[model samples]
Target: MKKAALLSIAMLGLTACSQGVQTMTDRTASPCGDKPNCVSTQDNREKYQLAPFTLTANASLDNIEEVALKLPGAKTAVKEGGYLRIECTSRIMRFVDDLELKIDGRTLVVRSESRVGYSDFGVNRKRADQLREQLKQSGLIE
Candidate 1:
């Protein structure tokens, strides 16, 4: 009983340490906050840099938004201009990760980052890739 209680408390403490959304500046999403739990086309760091995907002729902002919403634990948190911000929670721990998709010219730029912690075991990267695949499968991206 004592061990279980201690474990619960430790998990709660870790969850409480997660930070929320960081500010985005200009037309780019914020860079990773000294953490490996983030990846973005806006970031120049080799570990964080991801290529922006080109949009298909049939793709619209709504189509991309729909693809994001279909992902597990994902919800649209904000939509403005050509940017869509999504929040995804972990299945068990409920840790939140933020994903931003921006329409820059003819390409779609994506940024995914964990709300807290220095490592995410590649969850953010995998999530981004999953989203990209969904877009492609749905003919939203080429």
Candidate 2:
């Protein structure tokens, strides 16, 4: 009877240990590997390349106030001699006309011109082919 009981306990322990094994979830670290705390716990960006933008600047107090009032999510981080720093973001990165639009506080403002038509300029160009080969190897610009 004791041998049977021991055998049953061993089997039960094995079953419990198997059930306790953890499975890895579908997730990855930051796709760009820049934002250390990014929640992109999986390699999700199979198509879109990761993009990031950051800037620091100094401007007059009056200009800082004006910028703050005009842009959504735009904030001054440093101030000295009537000047301040501006850090900003927006919900959308829109390329329009000659400028890109970014949010300041609750509005869009001109930022930069959108780049386009690389193939039009690159396809027959050796430099273009080189870039294409590089991107293909990097698993980008397919």
Candidate 3:
């Protein structure tokens, strides 16, 4: 019985570790690995590449930050200059995904990456799409 309990606890620990977030480097998010767990607008690698969106005349850094903060699982966000970093946590297991956005003139570059795991089941991509839709709906992006 004790061994079974220990095994269960160990399994839970491993599960949590599997979804842990890694340290983000600099203002730009880290590059995506060979895994499919990350998506980024700045990436040139075809498998990890995503198209950036253009900001509208009404858009500003504050509006962009607001849209990201309104995300369902958004836990924390920080903005500096033209860069915004948001941390979104999963509902159940509480896994974290780091999303970084940088505005250059009218273009918004985005990057979303899982801290752990080799795959996010496309959640990262879906989240970026949702953000884009929100920005468009709010007239922040064109």
Clashes of each: 0, 12, 0
What overall lDDT, based on C-alpha atoms, would model 3 receive against the true structure?
A: 0.83
List the candidate numbers ranked by lDDT, top first. 1, 3, 2
Q: What is the lDDT of residue 104 in candidate 3?
A: 83
Model 3 ranges with Cα > 4 A deviation: 1-23, 27-30
lDDT of 3 by residue, 1-91 (tens): 9999999999988987775445455445456788998888777898788887998988888888888888868855567788888899988
- What's the best-to-worst order under TM-score? 3, 1, 2
lDDT of 1 at 135: 93
lDDT of 1 by residue, 1-142 (tens): 9999999999988767644456544334667767789888888888888877899888887889999998879998788889888889888877888888889778998998877777999998898889989999999888
Point out the worst 10-residue segment of candidate 3 by lDDT. Answer: 20-29
